[model samples]
Target chain A: MIADYGYVGLFLVFGIIFVAGALAVSWFLRPRAPSPEKNSCYECGEVIKGGSWIQFNVRYYLIALIFVVFDVEILFLIPWAVIFRELGFVAFVEMVVFIGVLIAGLVYAWKKGALEWQ
Target chain B: MIIPVLTLIIMLIVGAVVLGFIAVSAMFLIWWERKVSAHIQTRYGPMRVGWHGALQSVADVIKLLLKENITPSGVDRLSWWLAPFFAVVPVVMVFVCIPFGNIFGIELIARDLNIGILYIMALTSICVLGIFMAGWGSNNKYSLLGGMRSAAQIVSYEIPLVLAMVTAVMFAGSLSMQKIVEAQKGLWFVFQPNMAIAFAIFIIAGTAEVNRTPFDIPEAESELVAGFHTEYSGMKFAMFFLGEYTNMFVISALAATLFLGGWSGPFLPPVIWFLIKTYGLVTFMMWIRWTLPRVRVDQLMGFAWKVLTPVSFANLIVAGWILMK
Candidate 1:
């Protein structure tokens, strides 16, 4: 188990150092100019208009929700994919059924305008 | 025994070296990208730094080292500081399963876990979270939007990517990178009809996974203005840049190992052949980045879930049926 997580630990250490080092270096080098204009949300030099936290399109949320379902299905496919040659005919049939259901969901999304570009 | 200890020590040293190599390669690749873009657009690239700007990365490194790292006044200090760490760690971890050569296999591989492919897939997902943290922690709206877009894009394409991987695994009959490579001794998986479809899906998904061109909606320079890491500067920004490039190499290397007969060749050392194939894939990725235009976020997501996911899933079923006979 320890062996399994060795890379995780290494990653943690390096990640901390990189972030900390960056923060530390920026503290001393960059000029400390913090005027309201300097800190304002950048808008390509246009005057700040609406709040930055305005409501985003709901389409993104719909897309993400559908994505999660398909993504999980894909995960299930990985284990099946690795063992498919050995599982053979039984696995092939099982996968087809699985994909058939997912495809139905995809078609539903398509019909409901979940995939339409706004 | 003593051999185990020696092996452990050797693995640690080699792992460190590989991490350093990846960092250096990413920096060089950045400079190369700049020079290539400049030449493409008919402008001189880094002529002031050194002859052909070979030493530009080194200069950039020095400058970043000297640059001041700032913590935003209202930001979450801990997560803000930790974002870069999270960004880079998984990129390094993915290298373990890469079969560089026979003698240089580094077999212990940080963890000789049986489910190497699954492990890598999980680790890569963790990267999206880090990007989210960086964007949110920065307290910058553009950064936040970039992060959200990245999360959606990565999560969406990951389906096709995993499906494509599954097709390969189904044909290879094992999840271990070494086993998969070994299975390809006679003929690489890419040549297999089903695997060819899987490979195409994998490459497209891989491109999106690394947030490269066409799929680079997260960091759309024209719109998001540097995207999720917009607020990051100095070495912190460098870490994100390095992580992104390293992840690119990792995905490419894994693709090579799975489909291109990793470390298997006649003329040169196994490691050299493996690296040659890996870099060849990387160059292909670079070519795509240079040539393509960024896809809109909605179109990107639609293409993945609507198009890629279905095709890849169908490909898997087809592959399974073909293998069964």
Candidate 2:
């Protein structure tokens, strides 16, 4: 297991280096031309107005919060799913109940209108 | 203690090979998608570069290389500089565990980690961070909106995606990619009713995860300019392209392995079988991309949270009940 992870680590290191190396090579070959207009953030050819960073919708955060709850729930289910067959009916029942609790949460989220996009 | 010299050398060789494969595969898929989309629309795609624009991607790469690398004013320097690397590197790292069948009795995978599927899920999830960074770093309104949309979209769809994979893992009784394939030797999982649902869910959620069309509201050009990558130019933009197409490949390959019986076939070599299945699914994705219109963001989120999640969870529970009995 340790050695398996070692290969993954090796790949991770190599991948970062490879991307960085490509960028460095491009830096040497590419031109260095710049102007204020060229450097401005893209806004479909209109004079830049207010700051681009504005307070956005809270719905994005709400959706993110709901996602976290379910994502964590799914993560917990994975290990159980891997060895599920071996554990048989009793374990299956246990998981059904576990999932039932989560379903309740989902239903509550639904009823509360947390899932609504508006 | 000393590093194993032969193993290190072998790994370096493998890394170089995989890197080459990623570059070539991305280029080919880009060309193929254009052709597929064009032919669907009843027009010829690129035909100038090489025999029907076969070398178009190569020329494009060169053009990008020679172009200036622009760092827009008022951008977050650190994240802006690193976003491309973040986008490309994690996707590249996922090539580590992908089983490419065998050649001459040697397994083509870099290392068959026991937690193969889990590892892939983890790595691919990191891709969202890169897009988010690019958007935030660019200090552009469209990029920010695109980034936020993607983060929300990917996270929402991931539940169904994971649920589908978990169903496969339950059947296989292992998380290793090779083991999952081996479990399907007698019959492909797609042949089963519940597994078929799982397969459908996987493909749908996988498409959304990669931010493809129909589910591609994140980069919906009609609304968000170029989306999270609006400020990206030249090679940095190319890296995002590489990451997107490569991601399409990875998701298709995973679908092939988990649902389609992987490289297993009687008449052909395993590698040939694997590529055929993977690319077939990829073509199916492209066909869908060109055929369907992009979904509205509210509908996209509603579909994931309301429709896919509930249906997939119910499928998983039902599949488990069948397995236990």
Candidate 3:
């Protein structure tokens, strides 16, 4: 079974080599002249602003935190969903309860306006 | 213990063939997109190169090869250098499990792992990391914003995407892509009412995942100047382009296999059927891209959480209850 994943690994190696080979081939063919101005980062021809690695939006973090909760819910659901039939109807009700709890969490978040981007 | 040498050789051959397809298909899709978008815009694009400019992508590739590879100063050298490879490699890894149809004595899949669908989903999300690296490593404001928007968008849309996948897993009762395709043999999942909803959700979320129009807030060219790839040049930029088309193919192939009875039709060979369905979906996506304007970041993220996620969840429960009954 573990050997099955080896094909995936093999493909990854092939993909890496493909990109590297293309880049290497182009390296030989492509021009290499670069001035300081040519090497400068593009910013729509306006001289450089302050550093770009400044503080980001709080909303990105907010969305990420919310994503974590749902992502884990999905992780739990996959196993349950797969085996829910053999586990019987009781398992079905249990999932409803589980999803209900998550939906309630979503409602709570909605009430708090955490979903709002602005 | 020893692994069979024949199996290794066969896989190597298949890998090379897949690599060839990647190169050929990217060229085809570049030409196709140009023709499609041109017709939509009332213009004849690239007609002079070869029959309707079919060889236009070939010419473009030569140009790209001869173009300059400019590495800007002050960039994070390693990340900037490696980002294009990161963008591409994972998309290639997915083809191994995609069941292309049986030929000779074997299923044309490279290897049909038991966890194929899950594996594809997980590998695809890695693409955002590459984009984010391109943005951050470039040390440019627009690239950084593009990367950040992409990270936020993928994270939000992934919920509906995964949940929609769960719906398929529930119905198919397996994670293997081939088995999922086989399960749909008698009844294509899209034919069922609940599954039709799942298919809709899957395509919408998938469009977002690949960063196509209407969901293309991350790479909005008019706003972000080619977004995360602002600083990449020449062949490095070409790798990103190839990855986008290949990733589009991956998602469409999954949609075909999962919902459209993959590689299984009455008359024609299975691989041919598979190609038809997959390309049909790809063409549909390109049509949507040309027709719709890019959505704003607020609308893109909000639609994922509010509309798609909740509807898919409700649909999942309904499907589950019906399955129980």
Candidate 4:
């Protein structure tokens, strides 16, 4: 198992070098013609507005929170799903119960209007 | 020779081939998408370059390479400079595990990692971090909005996508791509009733994952003026574009592997079968991209959270029950 992950590490290092090479090629060939106006952020021909990274809606964060909850559910479910056939009905029931809990969470999120976009 | 030197030689060979595949396929897919979208709109796509514009992407690449690399003022130079690599490198890492084919009774895969499917999914998600960094690093409001939208969209859709993948994991009993393909030797998973549902959900969620039309709120030209990539130009923009198309290929290849049975067919060679199925899905995605319009942000979020996630979760549970019995 450790050996398997060793390849991932090697792949990652090589990948970074390869991407850097692609960028280096572009850097060598691409022109350098920066100007005050050219370097400004594009706004469809409009002048600069307020800061771009200002506070936005809270709904996205809510959705992200809900996703995390389900993500954890999945982490538990994957092992169950992988070994599912060998475990038979007992594991099936266990998974159903586990899913039932998540479903309840989903329903609560739904009723709470956490899923609502508006 | 030392063991480390031997390993290094093997890695060098594999890395070159995989990177070459990525670079070549990205160029081809760009030209192909243009032709497909052009024909969809009833226009001549690229007639001037090499045999009906097949070489158009080659020319485009040259132009991008020669164009000025613009670093917009007021940007966080660190993330700005590194964003393209972040967008690309992870995707390239995924190629290591993909089973391209078997030749002379030897598998053509790079590394064939045991945790292939999980590893690919994990790496693909990291591309979102790069996009967010690009938006934040550029110090542009539209880029930020685009980046945030991408984050929201990707996160919301990932559940259904993973759940859909889990169905296949259940059927195959392994996460290795080659084993998944081998498991489907008897029958492709998409043929099963529940597996069909999983396949459908996978495609829908996969479409959203890649941020194509109907799910492309992040880079909606009409709304965000190129969205998270609004501030990027020239070669940097090219990198993003290449990453997006290559990502499209990766997901399609995943779909092909899980549902359609990677590299499996009669008469044709294994690699050909794999490419055919992979590119067929790629073409279908292009068709959908051209056929559909972008959805509202609310509608997109609603679809993922309200509909897809629930249905896929239920599907997973049901598939599990049936398999268990």
Error of 1 at B322 (Å): 0.5
Q: Which of candidates 1 and 2 reaches a greater TM-score?
A: 2
> Which regions of candidate 3 fall more than 4 Å away from where they truly are?
B1-3
Q: Roughly what TM-score does model 3 have, to 2 decimal places?
A: 0.97
CAPRI-wise, candidate 2 is: high
User: Which fraction of the native contacts appears in each prediction?
Assistant: 0.48, 0.76, 0.82, 0.72
Count residue pairs with overlapping backbones in model 2.
0
TM-score, every prediction: 0.90, 0.98, 0.97, 0.97
Candidate 1, residues B1-325: lDDT per residue as tens digits?
A: 9986886786567666766777777877778778777777798889878888888988987788776555555566777877888888777767656666665444434454678788788888889888989877876778878988898888888888877777777777888888888899999999999898989999999999999998988899988998888877777887888888788878888889888888888978787788789878987888888888888876887888778987887787777666777
Worst-scoring 10-residue span by lDDT in model 2 chain B: B1-10
Off by over 4 Å in 1: A11-37, A45-51, B1-8, B42-44, B76-78, B103-111
The model with the greater DockQ, 3 or 4, is: 3
Off by over 4 Å in 4: A1-3, B2-4
- Candidate 2 clashing pairs, residues 3+ apart or interchain: none
Each prediction's total of clashing residue pairs, residues at least 3 apart in sequence or on different chains, is 7, 0, 0, 1
lDDT of 4 by residue, A1-115 (tens): 6556666777788777876776688888877877888888887777778667678889878888998898888888878777788888887888898888888998998899987
lDDT string for model 1 (A1-118, tens) is 6665665575556545645665676567666546655555566776656554457678778877887787677777777776666676776787789889989998998899988766
Residue-level lDDT tens digits of model 2 in B194-251: 9999999999999999999999998998889989999998889998999899999999
Model 4, B53-105: lDDT tens digits are: 99999999889878887888889999998888888888888887887778668
* Residue B280 displacement in candidate 1 (angstroms): 2.0
**Chain A TM-score for each candidate, in the given order?**
0.88, 0.91, 0.92, 0.91
The top-ranked prediction according to TM-score is 2
